[model samples]
Target: MLTLPNILTLSRIVTVPLLAALLWWPGWATGYLLGFVVYSLMGVTDYFDGYLARAQGAVSRLGIFLDPIADKIMVAAVILILCAAGNDRFPPLIAEVHVIAAMIILLREITVSGLREFLAGLQVSMPVSQLAKWKTTLQIVALGTLILAGGFREQVWMHDLGLATLWASAILTLVTGWDYLRVGLKHMD
Candidate 1:
């Protein structure tokens, strides 16, 4: 269970607190910069953990279990931090929109996770759809762009682009979440 791939996955879950601490101070350009770096590193580990697991035939039950949890934790931490910082720095219109977008994505994540857990207990595994993977990719890009925008708030366009990407990602999230629920619901009966 303590394979290299699993270790990488575990590292991401462990580093979330430090990431959160770095983003705690709103409008601190340096903190946002550090947060971006930490966030990028977490993203890298997320990719490599799965690749290494497949390549090395180290796909253990623990690794499979912890991988998604690590991802959700990291994503949740980043969204919360960005929302807090954005609200404190920007005016209500932009801040509130971004906060709502973040909340939508976060809510979908939690709902899907719960559905997956419930289905797992019933020996039903709902395979990930292509749209869900695209949604995840967009979500990560949107969050990364938003975090980078926090440090570069002087450029109004950066925040605009981030917010645009955020909304796109949220739309995809809702669609994919519905797809997953549709599949899981059939298993209930």
Candidate 2:
């Protein structure tokens, strides 16, 4: 339960508040720079936790259950913080379209999480699709890029690139979420 891998996972959950604090203020270049570093470290821990769990063959029930929850919590927090910061600073840049894209991704995460819980209750395990994995990969990259861009806003192109990646990620998220829901629905009836 308190294995090294689990400890790494727990660290991510604990550090999210500090991450949020760093992203609280818009145009706080230094804050965003620190946030980017912390965020990247969190992402690294995310990878190592799973890798260590598998390598050590210490995959506990708690680790299995808490891993995805930790991921969702982190992703959701980042989205909310980015959206809030964007709104406060670059209102036009994070306007309706951008907000909707973020909302769509958030909604999909919640919906899929609920569906996964339901499927678990039904004793049906749903493996992640390749596309879903790709989506997650892209989503992480997109968010990381955006956070870095926030820290380096003097370079307008960086922000533009981040926003573009974000939209692309949102599109993939919708597709993958729908795929997961479709699979889950088949088991429901």
For model 2, how does the per-residue alpha-carbon lDDT over 109-154 read when each residue is reduced to its tens digit?
8999899999999999988889887877777887888888878877
Q: On residues 1-189, what C-alpha lDDT tens digit does candidate 1 reach at each position? A: 799999999999999999888877766778778988998999999999999999999899999899989989998988877766544345422366567788889999999999999999999888878888888888888878877776776877877887898899899998998988888889876
Q: Tally clashes: model 1.
A: 0
TM-scores of the models, in the order given: 0.93, 0.94
Residue 27 CA error for candidate 2 (Å)? 1.9
* Candidate 2 TM-score, true structure as reference: 0.94
lDDT of each: 0.84, 0.85
Model 2, residue pairs in steric clash = none
